[model samples]
Target: MHERTHKVNAGSSKPRRPAAAGRSRRAAGFTVLELLIVITIIAILATMFAPRLYGNERREFR
Candidate 1:
């Protein structure tokens, strides 16, 4: 029978951070430019579709 021995190092006490730790520190928010772009896209889409939505609703109520 063969026995394998495991060795633990005492010099390093804190556990090593995972590879994902590098990515986890990112600030969670949209930049101003990104937010403006998203808002502009949404506004344009709403403007383009608003007439159709309101027009149909008005016709249905009559």
Candidate 2:
């Protein structure tokens, strides 16, 4: 029987950058303009559908 041994060289490994330092703030998430656009779209959709939803409920009660 033969046994083999492996050695790791920690010093040769590349150093990692800090999490915050590795990425820019803009790249991490949506911008203010993008968020506002999405919120506006959602509000518009809610306004468009809200009346129909409530109208159906009122008729079911009568």
Candidate 3:
């Protein structure tokens, strides 16, 4: 029976950044304030438009 062996090069592996560095990079996304602002804007727009949309539908049925 013959055994197959594999060779791995240590230098080929990528260097890992520190955990804090990774968290900072990942944290580049939206902050709580930014997310809240976006959600508020969406809610405001929905409130402004939703009633008009439903009103038009009701008028069409009449």
Candidate 4:
């Protein structure tokens, strides 16, 4: 692949910025509802398994 270089001015120069109407990459990530749903599912699973794991404190009589 050929290398394409952007030659900048020797000094005292700044790159141009995109106009206001341009689409940027900053508009991404999870929404609050999605996060809440994931958290709720995890909580439910933990609750279901916690009792089985911790409820084994049986005391057998001699």
Query: How far does residue 16 in candidate 1 sit from its true spot (Å)?
Result: 23
Winner of 1 and 3 under TM-score: 3
**lDDT per residue as tens, model 4, 1-62:** 99999967677488766575344543467668999999999999999998887676543332
RMSD of each: 8.7, 10.5, 10.0, 11.7
Q: How are the candidates ranked when ordered by TM-score, highest leading? A: 2, 3, 1, 4
The deviation in Å at residue 28 for candidate 4 is: 2.6
- Candidate that beats the other on lDDT, 2 or 4, i.e. the better one: 2
> Model 4: what TM-score?
0.46
Which candidate, 2 or 3, would have the higher TM-score against the true structure?
Answer: 2
lDDT of each: 0.85, 0.87, 0.86, 0.75
Candidate 2, residue 6: how far the Cα is off, in Å: 42
Residues 1-62 of candidate 3 have per-residue lDDT tens digits of 99998666687776655679868866779778889999999999999999999999999999
Error of 4 at 34 (Å): 0.4
Once fitted onto the true fold, the runs of candidate 2 whose alpha carbons sit more than 4 angstroms away are 1-23
Question: Model 2 Cα displacement at 19 (Å)?
Answer: 20
Model 3 scores worst on lDDT over the 10 consecutive residues at 9-18
User: In model 4, where do residues sit more than 4 Å from their true spots?
Assistant: 1-27, 57-62
What's model 2's TM-score? 0.58
Q: Which digits, one per residue and each the tens of the lDDT, describe model 2 over residues 1-62?
A: 89998666687775556687846766889888999999999999999999999999999999
State in Å the error of residue 40, model 1.
Answer: 0.3
